[model samples]
Target: MKLFKSNEWQRVKKSKAMVIALAVIALIPSLYAVIFLSSLWDTYGHVSNLPVAVVNQDQTATVNGKTENLGQNLTTSLVNGQDWKFTQVSEKTARSGLKSGKYYMTVTIPSDFTKSSGTLLGKSPKTPTIDIQQNGGRSFFAEKITDAAAEKLKNKVSQSLQKVYLENLLKGTKTSQDGFTKAAKGVSQLGTALGKVQTGAGQLQTGTMTLQTGATTLSNGLLQYTGAMGKLTNGSANLVTGNTQLAASLQKIGTGISQGQAANAANISKLNAGFDKVNQGLQQLSQMQVTIDQSQLNSSAASVSSGLSSVDQNVTAVLADPTVQEKMKTDPAFAQQVSDLKSNLTATEKSSQDLKTSSAALNTAVMQQISGLKTQLTTLSTQAITLNNSAKTAIQQLNDSLSQVANVLATQAAPGATNLAQGATTLTNGLGQLNGQSQTLNGGATALSTGTSQLVAAENQLTMALQATQNGSDQLAQSLANGAVKLSVVHTGTKNVQALTNPVKNKSTSLSTIANNGTGMAPYMMSVGLFVGMISFSTAFDFITLGKKPKSGMHWWAEKQTVMATVWSAQAVIMTGLLVLVDSMAPKHILMTFVVALVTAFAFNQFVTMVIVALGKMGSALLLVFMVLQLSASAGTYPIELSNSFFQVIHPFMPMTYSVDAFRQVISIGGLAINDLLVLLALGLVSMVLTWLMYHRKLQADTVLFPKTAEK
Candidate 1:
């Protein structure tokens, strides 16, 4: 208390210079508070004054058949808005303005801006960009302000585009919904058609079963027919053999007669014996049991025809023999006999040809029946077993019919044998004429004549049977071809049904947002105001003045702190008053704002006192340095997260760190100021304790920024 009322006080009270200096000292914090806080108070509000250049070169683009110029729209919006003082310029002008510091930042809208914007629905979508270039040489705050403006412009553009995109997307969605509805209806109709097709397929399946049954029946009938034909063929073959024997006998008679001029009289008895054999063979043929399978009719007839051909060939070869021809010319009776044998042989050959034609017809009929059965089987696909019993029954019926035919054929053979017997008698008479001729030749001639007559009878019978078989085969083939056509319809119907079923389908959301950059940075800048105000307080007042050493360090610290605290209190009051005058502080908590400022001043005063007392003039220099550090590190303007490591490390220990927070809490941002108050007060208490402990030596031996010289 005495120190407070001592020489320093008297000198301060008496000198106008000291009072003016103290007043000026007080003005420093007040001026800083007014200038910094008021400047930043409505920074966002006055951002329209911030210099920014807009270079819009965007050309119009066609989007969904609509012309749009996105970049031009953005520039126009920015120009009309009060957010920034947007200077519309060309690209070259914008660049020059940015470099010359005429504009803090330049936003260049590329020529493809609108084009790229329209590509939102393209296969390769491109994000439209607004290129922002900031002037590095500008004041950091100016640059930051311009950057925020740029960000705001960008967000505005994005929001506008997003709204348009959403509208277009909704329109497209509506169109797609309509298309999908129609497609769904079409698919439903297709499904209904498929259902009808499925019903047809079921009917076709039934028809296929019927076809399977018919195929089995036809197959069985073919089997039975083949058996009958085989029997018939065998019988015909036997008859042919008998006739051949008769023809050979006639030939033998002719040969024997021709050779009568020679001493081949033994041939006459052989020829007569051949005639007996021919008659016996004819009798054997009449009684022979003939059986044939209809399926083998063609092959059997072919065999018969082949045999006839061999007979004809043998006859020709024999006639062509020089010896036989010479004999024929020399013996007139032999020639007559040979001529009769040859005429009989010609008849036999004609019958054979007729038989071959009949056999061919029968063979074609059988093959057609087989083919028809195969077609029906193919149509049946999986239902062949259903017809097993019916096929067997049909086969039995066919077999019975064939048996009846065979019996008829057997009866018919008797007349053929009678004819053959008469032919044989005629042949025997011919052989009598050749009684002294060669027997082998007479036998050959007789056999050929007999074969011709029997062959004629067999051929006529075969022709009738083959005609019947051919009619049945033709009917079967027609039925099977119809069934195949029905199955083809069923197959096509199944394919159509498959195509109707759904084969392809498509599957389809709206993101979170942030406050504008200006709004987001408001709390930080408000906090920065408090820190700048505190730093100004230090610069305004001098704690370490040129003085004599104090006897007691505790009294020295107490007196200095009291004076500093008084000045700081006034400074805080003036600052808060200026804050109110500027209308910067939150009007709702005007009282709290003052209290916060006062508390902040007290804390800041203690900190400055401690630094000066502990470190003398060096302490003041360090405090100034700390003030600069706190500007960045106190997380006042920018986020603490963006601060460097060194500042971050010391942040918790600095009183301005809490002061800024406390000011912001009481001012613009509304939060619990208690924590900041607690931290500030705690830091103050720490500074006080540290000053008490550290100032003892420094107060007794303090140094000023300008030390006085000792008396020379």
Candidate 2:
């Protein structure tokens, strides 16, 4: 064993080409790492440097009487941001840039952007949008970063618009509060007015009842007056007829009085003639007495004195006799004739004396009575004349008055009385109507009172509702004020958020293309290449030389492992230095990357050496097969979970699996996996043990590739 080790070392040290070939063979894995890991070290750090295009087509518009240019503001904000290389371009330019891969994404503001934003107060407002077009053909990550920037811009615009909306709402709340206050006051006044109306309606009902009674009394009085008028009309007609008859009778009485006065004058003249005749007779008789006393008494004094005395006595007696007075009264001519002169003369003297005596009485009684009669007749006549005249005048006046009265009774009074009767009938009907209407009026007044009461109740309810509304408005106003304050805070927060527009800052560590899964595939590819390289190396060279086998299996394994360790260490150190020179290793994990890569190479070499020792050239074929299986289970390009169940089960057993995991931590994420390193070293130790045991068994069994051709 000692001689074989010395021979192998001398052979490698003397052959220049062998040294150069081994050195070049060790650089193979480093080349892969340098190419792949350089760009993946800080791949996302350069995302902000990616270009984006913007097209602003939005115009300015008036929103609530204020001029606004939303698109312009959005454009300015995007241009000022450092998240992306944004530029204001025309629509054509933006489209072309996105298609040609000059820009990762294109953001477009439509012409109606401001117009749509202004419609926020309308019934059905539309959401304003910013169109983002990305070139999916370019780097997917680049497109994603630009899309994120566009989304950020949209959020900023939305926050600013919401601030305006809150301000307007606050103003509206103030106006509504004022209106509610006024409504409350108006409801109070309306309640008072309704109460007054209810009181008035009750009074009106009472007054209507009183009016109904008065109308009834008036109707009765009118009926009585109508009857009186009828009677008065009839009486006027009777008076007219009686006055006409009285006028006629008075005229006749006037004529009779005038005739009686003339008759009375004639009678008085005859009476005076009779009274003169009587006086003449009395004078003659008185003269005769004187003559007889002078002549007849002297001549027949002696013879007739006695006889004459006797004759005087007898004549006195006869004259005094009622029979002679009756005869003389009956025979007025008896005293005018003188046939019995002596006797008659004596008788006449006696009669004369009696006549004179009676005349005196008669004149005293009869003439006085006659004079009184005459005087009375004269007065009566005079009065009758005057009365007749007056009567005629009165009659004329009465006739005139009666004629006028008759005409009045016929024309005026009669018709007036009839009209009064008709009017009374109408008044009766009117009273009946008034009574019914009064009842209806009472019902109406009652209804009015009830309606007014309802109105007052409604007004009171309205007042209460208004008070509640006022309180609600006040609360709403206060809430709006609080919202405004909160909105201000939001506005300030959004403004500050603008500084962090690009939350994901992508940086590129190297100028190398790291496409999809390129970084992930790097560690797997490096592991496979190194493992295959070691396998090919083991086949090309002979490190274990067993000339005399009088050693323990452990001693044989130790000698082979010592040589393999020296070669694998030199290869791992060369590859690690090359990766550092190319800037492939993460700067923070520089030392860890070197250590993991060197360890990974050692582990891979140990496993490949064991497989070759166990089966010679056939073992190389088997190792190749195992390499294929480990590639699938290594979890390099894809996680082990994504592989088939068989691959997942064998993942931990695969030597390259732990190496890939450790390399990823050191190179990409700038970390060290101590557990994976231990696992890899343990796998190496197991492979060494298996290789030693298998080599010992092959030697003991005298196993050779060609048994019949050669024998020891």
Candidate 3:
């Protein structure tokens, strides 16, 4: 204490510029630090909701209001005081309006909405439903807002349905309104009448089919019989023609045989005449022979005898001579002489012999020929007789056959004609009976198969119509029930949507205690400015501006910080705990309040030390510069925005900015800026190093080191 008193007090008493500069420099960083911790007011914990539009398509009621009544009424009741806003619009505009970015989502009711609405409880109702669509995914907060609104609408519609159903149930209809019931009864009666008609039509159809079948079968049989009869008639005609032709051929053959027999008999007569002529010729020849014999009886006989002798002699001579063995060769002249004479005798003898031989051979040949001719004639005669007999027999047989055929034809034709007449009569009677039945069949079957099919269609259509009526009535009753439920259940919850509000100010004088303490930390920025100025002042006084070294107060102040620490530490600890004791604390964390104050003090101290080390002995003049330039711009009390660029340059590097952030976290939120704790600890370690190097060097040659400080 005494060393500090003597060294520090003596230096300060002597160095006037050092004293003035020290005062100014020390004020800058301290003041800067004071202003910094002040600002940082709002941004705490506040959550919000979205706005929605509702559209109604129901047109059952009449109203003159601007908003669609059904949707507006429903939204107002369900969403009041909750964190949501609901508005009503027409169905046509609602969907497009939702896409228009003004609202988060939209709900729309469809037309035929009551019919749609009535389906919640009805049998076989494909209900009319509301559309609650959102642009955002269901996971988004906006979708939650939309869903909340949608649920409200669902409840409303459900209530409406219940209400309608209850009213209908309470007020029952006097008559049965079931359309199917009445339709069924009517169908039953109509079906009974149609049943009789169906049976009658069936019978008529069966009878008509039978008659047609029988007529076709009979017609086919008749045609076959007619063809058979035609073939039989042709065969009979061919047989009669064949018989006549056979008779003609037989007559012709008989005539030819008769002519042949007659010719053969004529030829035999001619032969007998020829034989008679031959006998006469024989007689004349004999007579001629006798006469000739008488005429040349002696001469001719003698010459012939003589010539015969000569011829016999010559013949003997010729026979004896080997060369002339023939008689003619030796007696040619003699032969010539006796030739005439011997010729006549020879001619007569030859004639007689020839006649005798010829007669004998002729008798034999004639006898044989006559016998063969007689046999041929007899055969021809027999053949002619047989031909005549055959012709007669054939004619007789043909006549008999023709008579029999005629009788058989008459017999067969009579029965056929009788039967044909009877058949025609029976057919006429049967056709008459058939005609009667056909008339009965045609009586009632107005049409046939198609008529029955049309009747079945009518029955089916009747059934469908009846079912539809029952369904409609049930739906109307169900609609009443749904409406009642929505009305009763929707009156309970508050609206869940609201608007964003203005940001709050942080201050020591603020109505909010936590907010005020946060404001108290603002002085630390000015303190930080002062802390910088003090370093300049302390360094300049002891180092640069001081002329004397041994007894200068600057030199004393540099070495004995324990005294300063005593004062600063006391100031810091007291200032830090000051707000906690003074006010009814905000319902925030107590640890946060202590933390704000502690960081503010720590930052202020670190800045002082850093400047004190950086400025050294000449820090007095530099301190004066730092005070005017940096302190005014420190933004401790007011913003440093008005200060020059040089001041702005160094403002962020100052510890006050971060210290202020830490303070804000504590006061505004309810905790410390634990994330920035590292920076503060780092600043503390660095300040010690700067002090050791700069202060020790300044202490060695205070006057020489800061020459200008010695001059001043």
Candidate 4:
């Protein structure tokens, strides 16, 4: 084993080509790790260097009286973003650049972008669209990166637009608040007016009730006056009849005087007796006339007329009342009642006037007739006494006096009584008409009273409703005022709007954080480097050439392992140091990172050595194939699950997969994975055992085939 190890170095030192090859081989893994990891160290970080065209075809628009240029704003934000190298250009230039691969992607703001954004406040709002055209043929990763950039741009534009929309909405809210404040004030005034109306309604109800009472009293008085007029009519008829009887008696007396003056000295006694009967009749007629004169019908009629006038005045006043007039306009039933009452009162007033005039005329005529009759009856009585005392002396004088009395009675008393009776009848007829209307009047008054009571009830209900309405109006006004005040308290500034637009902020807390893409990729790239380095070492060094014959296959395996371990250890140290010092990879545990690197390198070297030792020169090609397979199978670039089914199926079998996992645990924020180290150690041990077995089998085969070389 010692001889084989010494000869291996002697062969490498003797050949200048081998010495240079060994030196190059020692750096292969470091070079591969640095080159590959550096290329993608911060791939996304440098995405800003990729050219992206921004076409600003959008025009400005007005949103709630404010000019908005969302397209221009988006362009400015995109230019400032770290996602892509955004350049503002025309649509034609952007398209040209996109087609010619001058730009990796093109972002186009549509002409109606701002216009569509302004529609958010409208009933049928339209969603604004941004056109992102990517040249997928340029580079798959570049296309994907630009796609992500486009998504970020879309989100940024959405946020900015949401902020603008919120600002406009807040402005509209402020205007609405002001309008509500004014409306509340108006409602407050309306409530106040409703209160006044309620008070006026109460007053109207009171007046209506009072008018009803007066109407009832006037109706009752009219009925009483009508009865009084009927009695006066009867008395007037009696006066007419008495006047006729007296006129006939006076005529008979006048004829008796003319006949008795011619024939009676013997009939003087009988003439005296007849004169006594005439005197008794005259006295009864005088008393009847006095009674008629004392009736005072004119006064009662004037009183009734006055009452009617009062009722008319009261009704006029009620109709003139503004509240009643207004109610009359609205209530057809009440209006009709009032109109009927007014017409009836007007007719009743005319009847009362006519009755008053007739009563005065009848009273005067009866008084004149009574005075004449009393005078004529007293004269006749005195003449009858004188004729009785001196029958022959003054019978002709007495007869002449009686004739004068009869003539006065016939001419004045009878005609006056007849005229009074006629006047009384007319008055009674008028009163009867008035009395006939009295029931109607009483009914109307009662109806008016009922209607007034109903009106009062309705007014009470209306007042209650108005009061409730006023209260509701007050509450509404108060609520609106409060709402306006609350709205006023809301802020709608740029900062507030921005906060409202993006209400939730992402606060991520990474459990295992890697500094950069390079750091994250360190484990995979380093695993790949170690495997490639092992393959390169296997190709450069002579694995099958032995300087001396070995006693056992174990000795042969030990000799190769010692040489490869030295070289692989050197490669691991150099690669790990460069990853730290040159590449600035900050692993969580630097020592653990180095240990994982050494273990990974050793595992790869053992695997390569196993393949080379077992397959000879063909094993080098197979080692390359093995490395290629492991590269794909290892969860290096992406998770093994993200890879194809072949890779996922082979993932657990690949030694590099564990190596990468161990490296990642040490390189990032976690402790080194014990399972990964054990798996890697187990794979290396297995490869070493397999290689030993292969060497043992080959030695036995050589010994059987060429016993002399085996013995040497």
Best by lDDT: 4
TM-score per prediction, in order, is: 0.47, 0.49, 0.30, 0.68
lDDT of each: 0.54, 0.55, 0.42, 0.66
Could you list the CA RMSD of all candidates, in the order they appear?
A: 28.5, 54.3, 54.2, 22.2
Clashes of each: 48, 8, 78, 0
Deviation in Å, model 3, residue 704 alpha carbon: 3.5
> Which of candidates 3 and 4 reaches a greater TM-score?
4
Better TM-score candidate (1, 4): 4
RMSD over all Cα atoms, model 2: 54.3
Per-residue accuracy of model 2 over 23-50 as CA lDDT, tens digit each:
6666666655655566664555666678
Q: What is the lDDT of candidate 2?
A: 0.55
Q: Give candidate 4's error at residue 154 in angstroms.
A: 1.7
User: lDDT score, residue 608, model 3?
Assistant: 58
- Predictions ranked by lDDT, top down? 4, 2, 1, 3
Candidate 4 backbone collisions, by pair = none
For 269-354, candidate 4 gives per-residue lDDT tens digits of 54444445434543443343224322333343334444444444444444543334655777787577667555555544454444
For model 2, state the Cα shift of residue 511 in Å: 31
Error of 3 at 184 (Å): 20
Those runs of model 3 whose alpha carbons end farther than 4 Å from true positions after fitting are 1-4, 10-654, 661-686, 698-712
